[model samples]
Target: MPTLETLLLQLNSIKVIDDTIPYSQYIPLDLSISNLDLSQIDIKNPNDFEIYIETYLKKNNAKVAFGGYNEVRNLYKQSSLFGDGQVNERNIHIGMDLWIKAGTPVLAAIDGIVYGFDYNAGKGNYGPTIILKHNLENHFFYTLYGHLSIESIENIEIGSFFKKGQQLATLGDSTVNGGYSPHLHFQIIKNIEDHFSDYPGVCNQKDLKYYLKNCPDPDLLLKIK
Candidate 1:
């Protein structure tokens, strides 16, 4: 299994986001917009909003964007979004999102093998997701990359080897990704429990302690800030 330090070293080398530029340098608009606040821009439909976000990412020359804690909170409350009445207090977010235009490259954070993949189609869902299993030193864990294009899993074989920082997939748009702005939903798992291609990205406040322990802060590896 790998130690946290070893995983950090691998993720640091991956081009998950633009290191030369800060998110503020790329997205001048209030980060709040990425959340659930829809009043700032005129969005008659979901696709319209998705396109707007995708365009913004491209203009900023950002290969990937991060930061949206507040927005994700709002997404949970939206009935039209997750459709789960009243935020699943037990299902608050457990991952940090990396916003980038669809088709933007996604790389493995560590050397791992394909664990599973799935197409969870719906608003506030992880569409075309992939999970990789890694064993470092004596620690075994998993990494999940969600909201990916369908092409990402078209021919991927289970147990396939993936080198650290290898191009795993590309970001998917709202049409394919869950009905929201385009982004990569990355999460770390200590025990997958036979699950594949999908894991809880959110948890209720009551389970916060458990989820936090199971899913360590991804920034520990990504170090985006």
Candidate 2:
């Protein structure tokens, strides 16, 4: 069996934010969500969120601001406005969250077939989600893309094939995405246990060890740093 590091090296790269331009040239020095206009909360509309994210990246001079384990954890802890108080205790955050504005395009990290999808509606939950199954050198694994707009999975079918970097979906707003700030929660799973459209993006402290083994950090493949 291939090790996690080996598998990550084999998979195609997926940037949390756009990487078409040079990081230093496109990134900003002081980027943050608070500085943006919150009145226009519905970033799902065509091109709205994309512009917002681009602006933020330019402001902070950051090529990728979110979608890493440490990045999301810090955002959650600092905001103090998202999630239940049971964040660390609930083993919350089983994935990496891309904190771009809503409606940012989500791409497949590797070539794979659609395994499942669903709308897990609730507070601090993944409103619309999709899971893709990939096989690398005979080793099979799964990737979950959560907090997507309902339109993303409205007609997606099981077993559909997606090439690496293929646009799978777009980010959703807080109301559409479990009532929180906009972001994409991407996770890698070794075993799915018959789940579809939704899986435990967060775990209980008691099962931390089990989940940690089952769902390794997405950064192993993303390599954001």
Candidate 3:
């Protein structure tokens, strides 16, 4: 039997955001603590971050900014949802993020059935999120699409089917997307366990090992590079 990672690598042409935009138009973005540029702007403010993204995209002459799998970031300080000031603060991002304008269509990475959907309200949360269960090589795994527009889940069915690259949702803005700039938080989960609709997209150093194992680098499936 092929491992989930191996099966993912064998697949081709996967995308989770705005298929109309080619991968060539996507540039890599670094939001980790090492990025000195973040010190110049207020990372807590969505508007400021949006402007930063705009400037970055324009600078690179690209439409999308992608990266952030297993990256340690400081932006979570704005919300207590990530355990602000806690000893084991969850600052490590365990998913890939595609930074784009609000309302950009969010697509399915592969053909799958909707496993769960919910509006994860509150700051530093997923806002509207969806989890899709997929079977490849007789192995079951899941894909999560977070920070989506409310309308995306309003009419979606629990067991609805979506083809690869099919539009599943649209990007949500700061007000409704857990107070962050518009982006699609895409994650791949090998063992979803009891999590439904919502899962931990960030983890503390202590649990980093487990999270990293369960949620492999989305690039294995996306191949955005």
Candidate 4:
């Protein structure tokens, strides 16, 4: 049997956002703690973060700024959901983020059925989220699409089917998207382990190894440059 990573690599042309925008227009963005440029902006404020993202896109002449898989960031410090400044603070991001404007079409990475959906509702939360269960070559796994508009889940059923590249949801803004700049938090889970509509998109250093193994780099599936 092929490994999940191997199965993902065999696939092609997978996208989680607007199909019209080619990969050429998707530029890499570094939101890690090491990015010195972040020190100049207030990441806690959604408006400031949005402005920063807009400037980044404009300067790079790109439509999307994508990255953040396995990145250690300080952006979560403002939200207690990640934990206080004490032990076990979840500061490392385990999912890929595609920074784009709110209301952008969010598409399914592959054909799958909705496993769960929820309005995570809170600061630093995923907001409206969806999880899809997929079976490829008899290898069952799941994909999580987070930070979506409320309407995206309002009319959807738990077992609804979505085809690859189909529009599954629209991106939500700061007001309803856990108070962060608009973006899609995409993750691949091999063993969902009782997780429902949402999964941990960030982890602490102690659990990094486990998450890193369970959630392979999304780029393997995306192949976005």
Per-model TM-score versus the true fold: 0.78, 0.74, 0.98, 0.99
List where candidate 4 sits over 4 angstroms from the true fold: none
In model 1, what is the error at residue 4, expressed in angstroms?
3.7
Q: Look at candidate 2 and tell me the lDDT of residue 146.
A: 88
Give RMSD to native, each candidate: 4.0, 5.9, 0.8, 0.7
lDDT of 1 by residue, 3-30 (tens): 6556665654344433344444444333
Q: What's the lDDT for all of these models?
A: 0.71, 0.69, 0.94, 0.95
Kindly list the per-residue Cα lDDT of model 2 for residues 1-225, writing each as its tens digit. 878658787665556434453333432222223434633544433246456666677677664556434222322322333335463544245677666667778888889999999898765568898999998778788999988888899889999999887788888886688765577788999889978777877664667778888888887787654
Q: Report the alpha-carbon TM-score of model 4 versus the true structure.
A: 0.99
Model 1 residue runs over 4 Å out of place are 1-13, 17-45, 51-63, 68-72, 79-83
Scored by Cα lDDT, where does model 3 land?
Answer: 0.94
- Cα lDDT tens digits, model 4, 1-225, are 879899899999588999899999999999998999999999999999999999999999999999999999999998999998677999999999999999999999999999999999999999999999999999899999999999999999998999999999999999999999999999999999989989999999999999999999999999996
Give Cα distance to truth, residue 107, candidate 4, Å: 0.6
Q: Write the per-residue lDDT of candidate 3 for residues 2-101, one digit (tens) a residue.
A: 7899989999958898888999999999999999999999999999999999999999999999999999999999998889667899999999999999
lDDT of 2 at 73: 31
Model 3, clash count?
A: 0
**For model 1, what is the C-alpha lDDT against the true structure?**
0.71
lDDT of 4 at 18: 90
